[model samples]
Target: MPTRAHGLRSRYRSLVVAAVAALMAVLLSPAGAQGAGSGGARTPLSEPVYSYSGAVRESVWVDTGLDGDGDGRDDRVAADIIRPREPARQGRKIPVIMDASPYYSCCGRGNESQLKTYDSDGRPVGFPLHYDNYFVPRGYAFVAVDLAGTNRSDGCVDVGGRSDVQSAKAVIDWLNGRARAYTTRTGGTRATAGWSNGRTGMIGKSWDGTIANGVAATGVRGLRTIVPISAISSWYDYYFAQGAPLYDGGPDWLSGYVDSPEALGRCAAVQQRLADGAPRTGDWTPLWTGRDYVKDARKVRASVFAVHGMQDLNVRTKHLGQWWDALAEQGVERKIWLSQTGHVDPFDFRRAEWADTLHRWFDHYLLGYDNGIDREPMADIERHPGQWSTDRVWPPRTTRTTALHPGSGTAPGVGALSLRPARPGAAETFTDDPAQSETEWAADLDRTTTAKAGFRTGRLTADLRLSGSSTVTVTATPTTSTAHLSAVLVDLGPDTIRDYGASGEGITTLTDRSCWGASTPGDSACYRDTAARTAAVDRTVISRGWADLGTYASPGKGRPLTPGRPVTLTLDLAATDHVVPAGHRLALIVAGTDRDLIDPPGSTPTLTLDLSRTTARLPLVGGTGAFVRATAGSTAADAVSMAPGARGVTPPHPAPRVPGDGRP
Candidate 1:
């Protein structure tokens, strides 16, 4: 044996050798060096490392700052949470993807009508829709919240008002440790979202999506992004169009429709406020201003991913159009998907593509992955059914407003639309009748005694694509103190169009079922298939606009017109992305009172239009050059003249009549 000192020196030398060897090995390996460094190599976001089957499911009641139910306690929003079990087991925090909705227990979501399913202990074993199943496995915590008064939450249903919005905002706050929540409604154990990372994203469709928009408008922290599909930007816009009530019963009826427990009388106070607040004259009030998200766009800090069906009549396209415009104005980072289907989710339309895109979006925003999604095109528009195109910007930056003039044709109640202005003093007249529906007024194109005036352009030499909102400038005088004006843009083509204006909003219930993700006994991941409701007709109404003539200058109040005094009314039709094919004529139909969309005036009024001053400005995407070149070669002498109510043009076929229910 060696001496004790010699043995110690030998052991120290051995230790030094092993340490040097280990350092060298680490320095030689790039991956090992990266792992050891302060700035570590990032894990690939595309990998599916999280297990969906091993997710932990739980519930919490978030406190909204109101006693909506008048129970002398704050309203609580019920949230069903599903997250990766590994995160909580390993003491790791995960970001949240939330869907706050009122349809969790009623009416369901999407075309298939999906409802939430719970286990025996009231804990959610299976969440409704595919959001929880698909995202939970992708390392995201999915929270499906039951809006106040819906599901098992405690509150009166306020529709899209303060209670509805605050219900969602409170959930987001609780996730970020800013709000109070409990394990039960009144006196249960306290709960904390300690497993959350305080970063969240909100998404949903229809009313669910509207909640996303409403919550984002509050600029709450922890909400990083939002995806609102077919959402409502303004409650007034949903039920009214330019100061004209679009639906009856206003907010009260809608509040009752979505509220559950079958006892709407429980929320009678809330419903009464909605009814009492809504002015029948369609004038804007504090109630509407409080619910208008577009007006509060500046408060939105979260990035937006907006989707809308061009033919969605239930929520209408204006909700997306105006909201998108406001977001752009605010310089909010945004992406858009405009589809051809009516009120349909992207998953139902383009399943695989939607899944991939949404996955990548979550990876980039929530996972902090450096994906190139933000660098891609800002807009994806469905040109036709099952066909999509990308653009650098929405509404095409190259779009120009082209004006088309109106003139009388050889037929009675028939007129001509031209690219040039009509002569001075040229005018047309129509009488307002409250009982007539738009379809009835448009039924006889050549009839002279109808309550509407029709003007059509000659057959197009080339295809005309309208990509944005069209404006109708009417110079008319009302015989009475007030009158309602309805402007319609018609596609005079004999083709099948999506009849979203009809009941059910063009959704056809089918017996066929399609599975999306994993299913449970309580919540099946399967959904029924649906087809577009269509109609074959001689003419298809592309878009329409309504205005309470008295509220022309301001939406809040009316300015009555003097009898026989011409006043210019500039109204904007719904935005569209449609191709008016060659040989099809575009028509402008101006009528009084669209009974299908709004409550009619109480009196009959004769309205006279000054055709010389009246014009329709269309947002032509690419065919403006062709139109200018085509019209440049012609003169004013080419204007067509027709008698009133002549029998030259065929009437449009009877179709669904709903206010602002025009095909995109």
Candidate 2:
């Protein structure tokens, strides 16, 4: 027989051994040993978690501060939601993907311009695009909200102002249980987003995507990531470049154009504020500063996935370039996709690959899956149609800024662009005509009666790649107090380029259809096919820049110039990623006015350019070696050997510069 203390010690040892055996059993089990968390193995994005046909659809209205309709009550933002039925029925929480747009019931979305479709009970049966049809089966909820003052939402269109951003922010607050939402505009029983897991991601294109950028800058709590495609980071950049207005009208006109449901007269106050806020001088005011997301990039905590077309003239590449630079300065995690198409959706350009990539991104961020996407390359650049290259960084880390100077040439108003600056020659002069368009200015470089000055590099022996923004600096004297300055970069190669014509931006609609998702009665799975509009031309305008000489010193103040007094003007051209192919020449055209893009002054001004002091600084990949190898035959010595008064030869039938001033 053992003593009481001895018996107690023996029992404790037996209990410890039994517990260890039980833990080992669990570790050896196949189902329980998948992952090291209580949540078990992570769900794969390719696996369907719920029935697509059985997803639930519902609608609610979130309250905002504005009384847009002036009914004496706060405005309401309408939200339409679609989610898997199994998750909602079983009380299991799921993540949310939201798109806040003003075009749902108006201009529509994507290449086809598809709008929202409703059922008999006024519930949304079909959400525009394939987001709802594809993501519902993957255990995520898709919510589409009508921005305040558009479609079913109750408010005036503020045009990316406070109301536009707040309406979207209110929805995110409600989803996270921080704000209140109701079924009707005036009053109803309060509703809670209990089915949501409080994690949200926003994605959209153009104006819709703009809202995403605006909201993310606010540093909202629940928003995990944002994908802004061809989006505007600054409203001022969209309407004005530097100190010049891109169009005649300001944000007032844009507000009226986008506000379809509300009568124009009703929102006259808002529209008036918009017009007054954006002065004709193009100075930075409180209104534009409030709308600029790049300035507030430090407040952003969400990861960004930016997409833009290098040839996009509507929104332009500067918006993305500046915003991307700001984000990088803050050490934010970011990814980018740069394409050659003009203002086009990636779906139309790279359908299957885009879908798969987007799916993986959403799964990793929203669903907490440990996918290897984040460790992969951060950029995917499209060199040509259907040809893409991935790199660890955007703009390539090896890029360097190289300055090209105007050298002696025989042609009037034409010269060779060489690495060495030439001695001062007779200044090239051109009269600014308000009636002349960009097409007429670039038609013939060597024409005797042209209103623009052209400079070019000789036929390239190798490919020269330009990867970033280009700057044009000029020292000139103007005949008038005010003048408009325009600079264009041209690729003078006899090849077919993307035709961003007067009607459409390098896309033509066809009768045939292609499908991306399952179909319902309200929403069709198929859409019309589109073909790339290509044009065979002698020279293609790759990028353009403009400035008003009056606002050279400060955009807020205009100073009159003394007659024949030289003033230096520097203009930043749009960012680009293009390869000037072998045997092709890179041309730079400097003109006084761009009638196609901006409103011209009342009087014409003659500008005399100091060719010796002028230079165009370009960001080229591979530095000086690339430039030297490309122009080995036509050396700087050749440029110096040209006779002072010799005329340059002209290429016959130069391509017309496409008109890009108007709204898309």
- For candidate 2, write residues 1-664 as lDDT tens digits: 4798888889998999998887555333311122233266443443344676777888889987678657687888989998877766655688889999888876778776778878787888878888887777677889999888777788888878888998789899999998888876555888789988888899998888899999999999999999998889999888777777675367777677667556365788888889899987767789998899998999888889888887776778888888888998998889889886777777776778888788778877887766667888998987655678887877788888889877656554456787877687746788887666556665555454447777788778899988878899888789987778889887766665556552346666789987766566776767777766655566667778888777667755556777788888888898877888887787788887676676675568899889887999988888777888998885322222222343221212112221121132
Per-prediction TM-score: 0.85, 0.87
Per-model CA lDDT versus the true structure: 0.75, 0.76
Once fitted onto the true fold, the runs of candidate 2 whose alpha carbons sit more than 4 angstroms away are 1-43, 67-72, 260-265, 410-413, 424-426, 447-449, 635-664
Measured on C-alpha atoms, candidate 1 has an lDDT of 0.75
In model 1, which range of ten residues has the least summed lDDT? 29-38
The top-ranked prediction according to TM-score is: 2
